[model samples]
Target: MSNNDSIKKTIIVTVLLCIVCSVIVSAAAVLLRPAQVANKSLDFKRNILSAAGLLEPGKNVDAIFNERVVTRVVDLKTGKFTDAVDPVSYDQRRASKDPSLSTNLSADEDLAKISRREDYSVVYLIQDENEQLQKIILPVKGYGLWSTLYGFLALEADANTVVGLVFYEHAETPGLGGEVDNPVWKAKWVGKEVYDEGDVAIAIIKGSVDSSSSNAVHQVDGLSGATLTSRGVHNLLHFWLGDNGYKPFLTNLKNGEA
Candidate 1:
């Protein structure tokens, strides 16, 4: 074959390959997106129920969430409450570009660290019947030992005490830092205080809890060897719930402004 003809044939083949690959990817996305979204919503509901002490692995999470949970969204900076926007559908990477919804943070903030771009965040507020607030579940993510750890933080009605802690996604080692998901360790966080007197006081100590301590924070035994992972959780919690994080919103909730 002539060189010119050969080159033209190669170009045609390359173009065809690109088209075929694109079509396959698009088709797969179309077929899977719905199921993916449904699973995501169900998992989110399950996490919310778990944080509220209602999740049973074998039980119906959808029914429990539907019956007991009331979800609301709030502007973190202005501390103003708002109606629910679909948390699962709201994309933070896109929302961050909207100046009204996002608060400015340093280079070190988790949202800033892993984010390709910063945007407004979605906060899920869960309340029980009688209009009594049980736990304020915040969507939080941060760098862990190996990857970004995404989880929910359930703060008690006081907005300082911790009701429950659950990490629904992460990449830490299974036996060590991954213990953050273990029921035994997470259960220890049930009654802990996330802050003290407006100061961030919660910590994950390397050693055992000292009974002589007077702080309201509950002590969870750290993993036998996952020091870095434990510290990552400690720092992530302190950073996200501190001055640069959700403190403003929590303050408003405590004062009845929210």
Candidate 2:
């Protein structure tokens, strides 16, 4: 047999080909990293704008976001606005996994089912030219039936009324829990009240809300056949809006302390 066709030669060629391919792939990843990061940032900005209902279909996302949004960091424990961290550089999701940056949760306290929560969270504020808050968008995440769902919850300045809710990432089952992405279902959250008489009264009910029911304003229809996911949504919302989460911040905000 010819040397080129020999098993040893063929093995050598294959190894060399793999080495070349690996180098190319590594180089491409390194060269493209900045673009990937930029795209991810752009998508994040879009999601924030979308959650606040401030996104215009044909308008420049960056320009519009810059014109209306003010990013700030909030101390979860104090419920106060803090300048200790740079809002632009803060990485909350990463912080959650760091013991120094976050706090561990007990089973009872972790209604959202996140094992740990960051000590500080970034919030987006949509303000008028006068600097008065219009809408406040807060980040939230929790495990669904299958995977962690990350999203924004925007509220009117009162902090009790929802402006919009959108999950930017999730791995829920298609046609079931995935219905959370349905525009029609998301629309149902637009006017929902987060608090009723000083309590977190909002809920994703098992069935459709009765329009005529007195408590309908705080109820959302659960996704059919997705009970666990529905429960996770309910729990996460409550956890985020309750005393251990944004409630203190909302109080400070209303008092002009945040």
Candidate 3:
């Protein structure tokens, strides 16, 4: 064969190899998608359970989730339960970018610095054996120092007292802002009050919380050496727990209307 003929053959072989590799990758992705989704869902449920203090080692997440957790959709502005949307299929983060499902936030209302806020959100409910609601887990997210942090905040039935807070995803400097995921810091939020007399009062302080302070109930010790990240957490908590987030739903819950 001439040099040109050999080059053509080589080119054809390379093209065919590329095509085959692409097909294999695409097929693998399609085949693995369902399992990926199931695992993602399981992880999410496990986080919700953990936030509610219900997760146990060696327990089946799906079984425990089915037995104890109920998912509900809430209209953020009205604070009312709505059956209009399916909780299991709704994506709050995606909705925030969809004009019809979200709204632009004014500067004053956007403490978390999220430009748009979803109108509806999914809330997880944990109930006791008698079916009495024990805790409500609300999904929360906001920009931290370097990246957005996504987490679950669990509150007592009263809707004001925090049961637990956990950030499952974030990109921040390790040992600093990333400390938001630190178990010890998260534990500080367990008993903190999110609201004081109907106002969003909970704050992440710059230093250790003063136990003797009158507002101790509303304060959480900030992540040391990560002031920006701490402020991000504080602002996001206030924004979510405030009127722009879940305040309406919580208010209705308090009034026995939800």
Question: Each candidate's TM vs. the true structure?
Answer: 0.79, 0.97, 0.96
> Best by lDDT, which number?
2
In candidate 2, stretches whose alpha carbon ends up further than 4 angstroms from where it belongs are 1-5
Ten-residue region with minimum lDDT total, candidate 3 = 84-93
lDDT per residue (tens digit) for residues 75-183 in model 2:
9999999998888888999999999999899999999999998999999999999988899999989989999999999999999999999999999999999999999
lDDT of 2 at 182: 95
Winner of 1 and 2 under TM-score: 2
2 versus 3: better TM-score goes to: 2
Model 3 gets an lDDT of: 0.90
Tens digits of per-residue lDDT, candidate 1, 172-213, equal 999888888888888888888877677888888877777677
Candidate 3 per-residue C-alpha lDDT over 9-44 given as tens digits, one digit per residue, 9 for 90 to 100: 999999999999999999999999999999998998
Candidate 2 matches the true fold with a TM-score of 0.97
Looking at model 1, the pairs that clash are 95-119, 95-120, 96-118, 96-119, 96-120
Error of 2 at 96 (Å): 0.6
Q: List the residue pairs that clash in candidate 3.
A: none
Each prediction's whole-model lDDT (CA): 0.74, 0.94, 0.90
Ranking by lDDT: 2, 3, 1
